[model samples]
Target chain A: DAGITQSPRHKVTETGTPVTLRCHQTENHRYMYWYRQDPGHGLRLIHYSYGVKDTDKGEVSDGYSVSRSKTEDFLLTLESATSSQTSVYFCAISESPGTSRYNEQFFGPGTRLTVL
Target chain B: AQTVTQSQPEMSVQEAETVTLSCTYDTSESDYYLFWYKQPPSRQMILVIRQEAYKQQNATENRFSVNFQKAAKSFSLKISDSQLGDAAMYFCDRTGNTPLVFGKGTRLSVIA
Candidate 1:
């Protein structure tokens, strides 16, 4: 179990409405990531941040946007919710990618989001 | 881009028995990392095992072990003395310098 927490463990929003999910970490890790899990898709990265204000798009980042203003918090926002975006979202933290200490990422419990 | 493939969509094993889950990946990078993750009904992702490409010896953690064949581009997970807690969706992943690429996943059912 990591010291990571996602706010609004379960959310249901209507279509075309704005939605935001928050990921907060107490480990002070350097890297944080947002991932979405679906039935067929194991887990797809939506966005990642190396440091505060530094973020990169992942394989599926079309409808999602992210912001990391501080080391402990990362936010994922959907401007307009869609049915396709309904899935379980997970937050991960790692100290370093190449280093042995942080080679493996620690995942949060996850947040289930539903859109109608 | 790197890709991970889990051939078996589902597997079953009796309690106290051993079961193996197959995984294969495609990548051009010589040095990388491979991992097996387990997600239970609670939807919490847990790390089962990890294997470094440079290490010839397979990695093991308690009852979980990996059979990594670098030349064959295959990394399989073996669970010994399976328990009810072992029943879950297992995912195989690979990563170099980029983000991890995961397979579709294999659901394991532990039958008593």
Candidate 2:
């Protein structure tokens, strides 16, 4: 929902190859986030962006990088993909948090990525 | 640091019955928020309910309600009059100044 879309809903990449996942939102929200979901791990934040050209690392930022060049787009890049990097990635968007309104993060459908 | 824990890995509930999923969290901060998110087979994360730490009253939404005990650091979701459509993976989450920390999740199966 929230007018969010992820490209290549399904992707397969070879280990050591570089890969990128794209997230786009039409709601013009100021906050965008990238998360990976795994069994027993729930969802772990990979990286998040607060505004255009502003980003920060998350709990699991070792193998992930993100960039927000525009208000609607956020990209997560894997400089060198590995089998351990394969997981279902979800993108979420939220308006200014700490406010009572629009604080909920609406998630995208998710992308299933596999690294061989 | 904030951490969420869902004790029940899986549970089953009969149609038209009620079921409760347990969640416990650890946080030192006094002000924060907790949320319940449902991920069905489609894998889309849907917000079910939210509870503010400062509020004593439990949060409710139709058939869904939460038993939030701030002192106990426990937040549990109760689904009454369950429907088959309610079957999904439910995740418990907490957030303060940082991003949300989620529990592993509880898989709920609604039996007909």
TM-score of chain A of each: 0.95, 0.96
Query: For model 2, how does the per-residue alpha-carbon lDDT over B1-112 read when each residue is reduced to its tens digit?
Result: 6789999999999999999999999998877889999999999999999998889999999999999999899999999999999999999998777777889999999999
Q: RMSD, each candidate, Å?
A: 1.1, 1.1
Clashing pairs in 2: none
User: How is the predicted docking of candidate 1 categorized under the CAPRI scheme?
Assistant: medium
Off by over 4 Å in 1: A98-101
Q: Pick the candidate with the highest DockQ.
A: 1
lDDT of 1 by residue, A1-88 (tens): 5799999899999999999999999999989999999998899999999899999998899999999999999999999999999999
Candidate 2, residue A69: lDDT: 88
Worst 10 residues of 2 chain A by lDDT: A96-105
